[model samples]
Target: PTAPVAAAAAALCVLAVSPGQAWAASADGPDGPAAYETAEGAKPVKGTAGSGDGPEISPGTYTDSIGRGEKKYYHVDLDAKSSAFISAVAAPEPGSRVKGVGEGLKIRLETVDGSECDGGTEPQFSAEGAAYPVADYATRLIGADDECQKAGAYLFSVEREGPETSDPGRWPLELRYMSEPGLKGGPRLLPGSPDSDEEPGDDETPAPVTSGEKRQAHGGTGFNDAGALAKGVWRDRIKPGETRFYRVPVDWGQRLNASVELGSANSPGEYPPTIYDGFGITAYNPARGRFEDDPFVSYTPDESAQAAVYTPTVDYTSRFDYSTNTPCLAGWHYLAVTVSPQLGKFFKSTAPLTLRVDVTGTAKAGPKYAGDAHAAGFGVSDEDKEQAEKGQNAAEGERSDSLRIVAYVGIGAGVVLILGLAVWTLTARRRAEALPGAPGTPGALGGPAGPGGQAGPDGGSGTV
Candidate 1:
């Protein structure tokens, strides 16, 4: 075979064998509760005792740990032209204990001079005492009169607070820093006014889609690895004390409505008849900021329960409007659903969950960004839409090993076939050249003919 063909075959063979390594890398030992997946290549850093002395973190993801009642600080350098956001997620062990309403995580961003950039956020567990992932973000937006506008260096403080009886073990923390580019010029339009009307009742809510097949969507444990969901019915199973996260891509001018239905427990009569805070659903914006208060339903083992959230149309100027600020960003919005740990006392099996998502309104052109919003993880792309349609999970380092194996096998087979054909062609040409009256011989088709008016032994006509 030619050198190029040999090299190509070798390269393809390497590719065919490399997926085995990927399979090994992606494999997890036995299924337990899904854990929060830190961002790929997230730098591991330790927070300092003081804000000024903390290690400087860039605009990316990082992993750390925080103990009960401990405050950790890190630094970030910023510019005046872009808005910065830092999101922190605190994940306790699956079976750990937590307070019903006050035990969780808090985050705050401030300038080096001790001026608060934004009010801090604290996301706590529900009254169910379920130990799940809690997340919130702090931001420094560029506005006409906002603190931290002319920024140089800023500090981020993450604190874990819980009752003394709660678990004292340190919880894993996942932090992300995102920078939103400023507009090219000034505001394109004025911010919308807040709506004074009350939230719509269940009768007025948009009906869930009932026509399509329910797709399988395994939710992630945190925002970074949230499963992609579209406007459809998605099915998954959740255990007691488990929380799952899913994201839907909402463009400018689009409104999002989502709900989760918890199916009745199996063998309800086996346990007590007490009512519990059954299931809860929460919504968050692109920056991991909670948009609305978590809505939960009273759950009894004997019956099913459901909860839902509806958001206004996404607009860039909505950030300036206090009432509509949460859903203002046009990007991947998140939904987190949780099942109460109290269910475990009454049921032994995982409960069924149905997520219904509906996105309405025509997509509109977004505002002009002075920088690349996509690079900063702030805009939606065609790939994001495709993933949502396929119900693809975004967990880092997790992929379909079977699909990859099939692909590698196909590629390896194709390379072998090509090389085989090349070898066969080369061998046939050589054989023909060695044959009597073959090419380059006297009586060959394009070679000199044998003696005049005579036929060659190989049955080729001579000069005549």
Candidate 2:
């Protein structure tokens, strides 16, 4: 074979073998801990972040459903190189029989010196009817130029707001707290809420998908124990201001897309005049960190009589860059859905939010860094890390072995074919040269019989 043909065959073979290695690399890449892994190990801590006696907390999910009208505080310690993310998901407002004014609960993050971290007072209401829950979240980096940037104890408060009521039922709170590595010992900018900026406008509304009769129950109620789902559409429920957290495992090079489908109101009409359906959805990376300067607003305008969907493509995490601001690394990414309250005296019955998650592209692992497997703010356990490393090594070895066998067989077959073709060509040439009437050879018609040399039917020279 010519050099060009040989090179072409080699290129084809490389292309054929590349996919298997790439796939194996993704399936066995550096596996991080599952989402909400810390939820199971979180210890119960009660009381407030003040009074010099608040219970200390760490990276985990905690719950509170008892003790009505009592203020609860939890304290988290921060290092000089870390930032904190705190979220509170409150249970739906309970239905009351007695008539009373609407009341609310106050949640705030503060330092010991009385500095507010993030978020303001959010109201809670109870009446003669049923109401849904509420979900509020906040994030603060422990550095300069921000409130409570010092490396010390910080407070997370949940207290009663508005007028006191006779309802004795306590609110079930799903609390999530995590401390991630800060950037250069400085406070980074936080993304503004889409809900705050949305107004009643004439922008084109996306058509939402309707839920089918067949549905699956979500794994858990809150972000801490978020249910695991494969790519496709899923049907689930969320009350007023209630939030549900779900996680999808995306490989290093995969693209993740998620959207929420809220039930529409009565008929094909506009949203209720008095009701403002507020819903928002956002996603976080495996390290529970968001991409920097990349405005990620999955869904806005929280409510619609028709279905609402927000699907955005996520950039694959890179292996080279370790900056917390950039979206890098792989593992279980988080999707949070928040449903705001409706202040009108109306009850609209409709299907639950149909969450559609589509993951495309081949899985390729991001950069592998030694040390903390969960350095990107993930709670990866030592066992999970060990298992991932072992599995990766085994899979890679298997792939290598299989590829070696295939490569050997392919190369051998290719060489044999080339040699057979070369021999056949040589034999054909020799046979032609040995022909009886071949040119420049001694044969029956070797010399011209006539003036012009020409071969006759009797194998003798004839006159032209």
- Residue 333's lDDT in candidate 1: 91
**Deviation in Å, model 2, residue 339 alpha carbon:** 9.6
TM-score of each: 0.80, 0.46
Best candidate according to TM-score = 1
Query: Which residues of candidate 1, in runs, are more than 4 Å off?
Result: 1-32, 186-204, 270-272, 325-327, 395-464
Native-structure RMSD, model 1: 5.7
lDDT of model 2 at residue 185? 20
- Angstrom error of the Cα, residue 252, model 2: value is 9.7
Report model 2's TM-score to 2 decimal places.
Answer: 0.46
Clashing pairs in 1: none
Q: Model 2 over residues 271-377: C-alpha lDDT tens digits?
A: 43433334555566554444332211222233543223222223322211233333333566666665444421233322367776655555543333332436444
Tens digits of per-residue lDDT for model 1, 142-242: 77346788859888999898889998899999888888888887334334432323342222557776668899886877787788899989898887777
